[model samples]
Target: MLRFALFVLFGSVFAGCASIQPYYTPNPDIAANEVEDYEGPLDAELVAGTNIAQRIARREAADYAFIGSAAFTGAADEDWTSAMVRLGRTLKTEKIDYFTWYAGTDTATGMTSVPVMRTSFGTVWGPDGPRTVPVTMLDTDWLPYSYTVPRYEYRVLYYKKRKEPLPMGIRYEWPGEELGRRIGTRKALEITLVVPGRTGWKNDLFDGDVILAVNGRTPTKELMRQFCRAPAGGKLKIWRDGQIVEKTISADPSEGK
Candidate 1:
């Protein structure tokens, strides 16, 4: 009974405090002397811990640039997938392209109070010729119930995924990711990432939109790269909402030259 009451009292308070804040700190050295444009989360990739170690041992760090890292605390019951997706949407705004994470448990303390009620028998002198009456009263107990919470300290390292391994920004659907999402189920480059609040997003070009043609030419892997790297004053035909729509190209970052 005590434990149940305690939990009921503290459940809301605990849930309110459950939010995880990933405090991101970037390596200043890399921040100052790196590429200016950072594509959105669609271009970022998550790395396995073992793969990170192998890449370092092989001196292949040049393939990707180490950007920075973030440290956060999470409860033992927290979901890693939810955390990563939330982080991807927010952290990539800082231009983080690649990331890896690990965690360890630590003991943390929590405190709350449960209100207790007591029942007693009181005699009424004048009511119904002194009948026994049951009286309920607040215990006025301020005693707090305290317990320990298991906390996980998490660390995430961020990197800029160079395009050498997997092409950034866009991916083609030819036995590839998004193959099932190809426009008309035909081969096309699926737009997965676009800088938020930019001309592209402003003009209705967004992730999941498909590039059916560029400047009256069929899209190839190379052509897709050209269009994204330095697009300027051209007709970009895209497939969206089961309709062929054309977006005006401008010299925006990562949009083209």
Candidate 2:
């Protein structure tokens, strides 16, 4: 009688173990608002490409409207509102006229539809000890789980004027190492200096301006070379003083060397 009671007790515990369900925990940084659900399959490459394309398109359009667009990453300690305010102040300093912000959920919830089997207690045989066996049930299946993921947001800015050219006397450098770390790409070329009294255009740009993109695309070494060689003009989206300032560029005639 005692042996039978022990078997029943062990079986109950095993059943309980098999019935456990998976759970998810939300990240603190995620906002209360739940963003749109992704309808497609959970493919990392596809999702990343789509998001990147969307961001790039927005930046380009804004650059055409404002002469440039700047990008900012939210700090670990800052909330969304604080980040927006900080960016806004910088844009105001750069004399940016129109701007728009976009946000996306940093985490996605994943659930599984398939059921799975788990180890559970089985009946005891007279000759053998209590047996363990595989149990399959609806409740025993591993349920869906959720996790936090990092994503990118774009803050596109517009100038009061359109297609404004870069100030005449400025020279840009591809500050590969420093800017590469900030922008997450070594390909970033930033405008590091404005030569005093070199050109006729007003000196509106400041030092440490990062060239985010050219003609709505991230500048590559080959593209920069082409921009330098292009005769008529080229469009550029520059990050200046924490804001994106758009500018049109024409080959500098004075710097023939």
Which candidate leads the pack in lDDT?
1
Highest TM-score among the candidates is held by which one?
A: 1
Query: How many residue pairs clash in each candidate at the backbone level?
Result: 6, 5
Measured by TM-score, how close is model 2 to the native structure?
A: 0.28
Which residue ranges in model 2 land beyond 4 Å of their true spot? 1-171, 176-178, 199-203, 250-257
RMSD of each: 17.0, 21.7
What is the overall TM-score of model 1 with all chains considered together?
Answer: 0.35
Question: Which pairs in model 1 have colliding backbones?
Answer: 228-255, 229-256, 229-257, 230-256, 230-257, 231-256
Compared with the true structure, what per-residue lDDT tens digits does model 2 show for residues 51-82? Answer: 43243233323321222344444322233323
lDDT of 1 by residue, 63-136 (tens): 34445666666666665434443554444432223333445445555555667799999988884588788999
Clashes of 2: 5
The whole-model lDDT of each prediction reads 0.51, 0.43
